[model samples]
Target: MPDFTATTPHIIPLVYQPDSAHWFALVRHLPHAVWLDSGRPQSTYGRFDIIAAAPQCLVETRGANTSIRYDDGRTDESALDPFYLLKKYLPADQLPEHSNSNLPFIGGALGYFAYDLGRRLETMPNLARNDIALPDMSVGIYPWAIIQDHQHKTACLVINTELGQRLGDAYNFLEIEQLCASAAKNPAFHEAINCIKSVQKSFKISEFESNLKVEEYQQALAKIHDYIRAGDCYQVNFAQRFSAEFSGDPLIAYLALRQALPSPFSGFMQLEAGSVLSLSPERFIQVRDKRVETKPIKGTIKRGATPEEDAANAEWLQNSLKNRAENVMIVDLLRNDLSKHCAQVRVPTLCELQTFANVHHLVSTVTGELTPNATALDLLRDAFPGGSITGAPKIRAMEIIEELEPTRRSLYCGSLGYISADGQMDTSIAIRTLVCDGDKIHCWGGGGIVADSETEQEYRESIAKVKVLMDTLEKEFGS
Candidate 1:
């Protein structure tokens, strides 16, 4: 075990007055940058948004290879589990007490854990093709972060000065201090930051392609229904991948997506191979003070054109027996997952109506207290991926997903957020997420198919979920 020095972070207030998107614009150019957005000034689901760039250390896992890259030109290789490597940097007992309890994340690991990483945790048949090869996990250990508390309408540059001092990186520490000072003391610093201006859309105007045709998608749904009837599983989430030739700054597309469809758990991450723009509305899990909560979005219905229609749609989603059953199925699954590392597990909210920019969903909240000996990592490990997206009888549903979905799910249905050094963790299910791999950008949409699920309705539901994203990108970036 390595020794990590404990140090309370210093908070420097910022008067530049920037929202999560604007503050992120200032540091977006930095490598390995991440923005855990709260969809502030618009949505009411989230309160705190954390932004960090140029990590002091990066822990990325690809297949069985895990590498730790440090800022000072140091690289260490390990074959240990990615969770194990991440846990090393997050020592619960050694973390300094957070100076401000309002901030959810000060300094910690911020990144994405791809859904495919589940293969590493549980033994499953390798039936799915490994078509897209990306890091299963990519997280950076940030020494400093800009945390915005939307509830208080306050923002601060919080730095772990002790970690910097312990590393003897005086130059880096001084650079951060100077950066904070400049932002506070100089109004001109705003201009000094390279803000991305509106640019012409760069995506090809050609129609987006899907891995499964409408008929094929329906056929896949039929298979899931058969499985359910055969007593193989109760529900299985099936998704279709849509991709287009994209050639412009994905940041532009991300900016467009956020504006069009703001979500509580939305995030944007710059990775080595590409970038991730997630407008996810589902929260996979959150841990604070050893308390765990998982919000699963199981049922969804498109927003109606009129206010009356919207209200009626919300009412329908709330009362629909099918939707409520789907929500409960996942809630029960999550309760079971949390029980692996938690005590006094309970579902506080079940089948609650939550409306987003495009659709209304039934979301359930499952919470528990971590056992005395269990850590946040342990809780996450037992609940890899998420039950809502995976469906009931998680492992079996995953197997069915592998059999049905044509292409591999790279980042879709994964999680993107932060695990703080002080043992606080918050992550979102990477639903409504996009992946920019080289010249092609991929997007996925899916819904759970149950025994009584309608193939036609499920097909439309899948397309409806991501239609906004596809339309937004094509309209903005399509050449």
Candidate 2:
């Protein structure tokens, strides 16, 4: 097996900026561009934003098929496990240590691993319709990245020196350094600004349509209630999909949504098929220096109109017995998943109140140390699509989700983030996410269905979670 090892990254310092939206203009037009954005900018949860474009290689997996296409016209296809295939290229042992511990990613695989990819990992009955035929996994092996450190007020261009040496041309350190030096002076920024403004006025639709009607959603909730009573599963996370016709650049929509609803684990990826716009506040997993942590968000309540109302709403969520039970159930499931590749698995916090722009969430922190032989991908494979999104008994919950949900979840409830060459990894639950494919853009909102979960309350909660996102886009471009 050929290992694409990386040497110490060449970090070139650049001017600092709080809002990354302007800086992203530099690489927006590049092919296969990706931005792992900390949407909150300089806040506590928000610290780093990594942007990369024109990957050295692209890895895409659909069902049992995975193809790795390199920039030099080298292509390889295989039916191997996607995680095993990724391991061949991103083996954790090959990365060298660097002094810059503050930055999470220098150059590595940055993209989305779709929730449907779980089918490739576990044996489950095919029930949901595959209407949105997106690749289960699509990530680019980038050779260089532009990192924005919002907390320290610093920015830099980091080039993976070893990968650059092989790719040559624009990838070489000198060329990238020259590119960064001339970036600010380039005339493209003005054009990018104009392009964004023009695209913002392109939406023609007046409303979004959901996959499930109110009665249909209520019926699905009844089935979940039946399962809970019969001891089929303790809890199952159910969701509804909403879609609108979209024709213009999706970046305009992303920019609008992020501004209105800033989150810690937000990301945007431009792919060959379409684009992924995520504004997720939940961290599915993070691995650094062999230490692992997964933050699962289970409970939720919509934000109130006034300050007092907001506090009361948050307090209600924090004290909700049903929500707390739903949260702890998933926490236990994740603990078992982490233990498969980690040691001394522990839960540091449970059902802690964390408020986002649109909702109040009960977020819990689960931590552990990676077993000596385990890699980041190994940990990801064991945990798969995350327990919080799936449910308490993950396999059973996923089975129920498949049986009840009308259509396949292409990107929603999956994960979007990075696994750096330095062995550091972080990913979002891919909730509050939108997928722009073909002529339509799709979004989903859902919550856990416990025994006591009411049909009306669950339905209202689902819409409440993503109401801000839908409103923001529709307000900006009509629908």
Candidate 3:
């Protein structure tokens, strides 16, 4: 294989199609920084279209020409280890690291390993080497590192075709603001929402049994546990069940869904056959001010119908010893991972439960200063798969995962985001995500399993977490 380094400026693009507009792109320069001023009107100081951050690292990549396919049957282990490859291409010493005192940049990069397929890789011809035609609408590549401001809207689209070039050159923050303003003034956004609602009316809920019987799954899980006992790995995330299928262009479904539910990490990526429509809200990793911080989400409890009930559930989750222990295990795991590349590592913030619109999570902040020789890539490699998903003693966990899980986890648990030419990087854990290929859609959800893990609760949590996506799909297409 060839070792390629990014020497020139790279433009990462993000494209999206609302109900009213044709596909549009958000473009920005890489390796830029964004400073968020919570109290200010415009809270941004970076050049990038979109930025997704993570609490810790969990991204992997198979190098060019090696055939260790994670999803497909092809298994070649020599594929560039994403962590190792990143270290060689983008080192920590060359990039800026964030500190606990300062804010950190966050983002993620997740998707099917299309690079493994020679034919698929051709479509996304590397811009670093050649000048290729871009879509009519394109956005800048997401900068990996930046300061996130919660006050102002910080979003961008990335373009990668002629259409993208035209849209990018004409589009800017001001233009986007105008578009959003106009969208808000008129009923376009609302109309789009209603359209999606109409489509969702047709969805029906159904369950299917796995062809591989429960015994098969049990055997897999047992092997995983055996590996765990053997100490070959620490925590391995295992998942089962391959479900969800449809007939139609996923892009259409993607457009409709975005209108109904707009997200900070909304993206439309062109791939083989069809494209991937992601509306993820999780950040995988963020680097800013020379300090690196990661927030791994471990626990989940559903929201209640009423405000009082919701608050009660959130409070209950916060005080749940079981959830807290799970969150803490990953927190400690992340601290040790970061310490590999930095000194003075600290877990100043322990398990603090945070709630989002959909579910509740036990979140903790881990911080560390990069050592003289460490690079962002080094930190990522040292802790490739975030512990929340894998469990403690990461390696053993992985072996367990391999044995328990029946299907290969392509982009479900991997990382997704961007890396800048300047060495700033950010990524997100690929959870609450959907991966589609033509008519087939694969979505995965699992929780950390300790010695005290309950098979039924764990099963329920996985199903509950996936309910949102399942419901969304049901609403889109009728049973």
TM-score on alpha carbons, each prediction: 0.94, 0.95, 0.64
Predicted candidate 1 versus true structure: per-residue lDDT over 223-267, tens digit per residue: 888899899999999999998877767777787788889899999
Clashes of each: 1, 0, 92
**Candidate 1's TM-score:** 0.94
Q: Using TM-score as the measure, which candidate wins?
A: 2
Compared with the true structure, the alpha-carbon lDDT of candidate 3 equals 0.48
Tens digit per residue, CA lDDT, model 2, 79-103: 9998888776575462233324567
Question: After TM-score superposition, what is the CA distance of residue 198 in candidate 3 from its true location, in Å?
Answer: 11
lDDT of each: 0.82, 0.85, 0.48
Worst 10 residues of 3 by lDDT: 130-139
Which predicted model would earn the best lDDT? 2
Q: Each prediction's Cα RMSD?
A: 2.2, 2.1, 10.5
After superposition, which runs of candidate 1 have C-alpha atoms over 4 Å from their true positions?
A: 16-18, 92-100, 165-171, 184-195, 200-206
Lowest lDDT sum, 10 consecutive residues, model 2, at: 91-100
Per-residue lDDT, model 3, residue 340, is 86
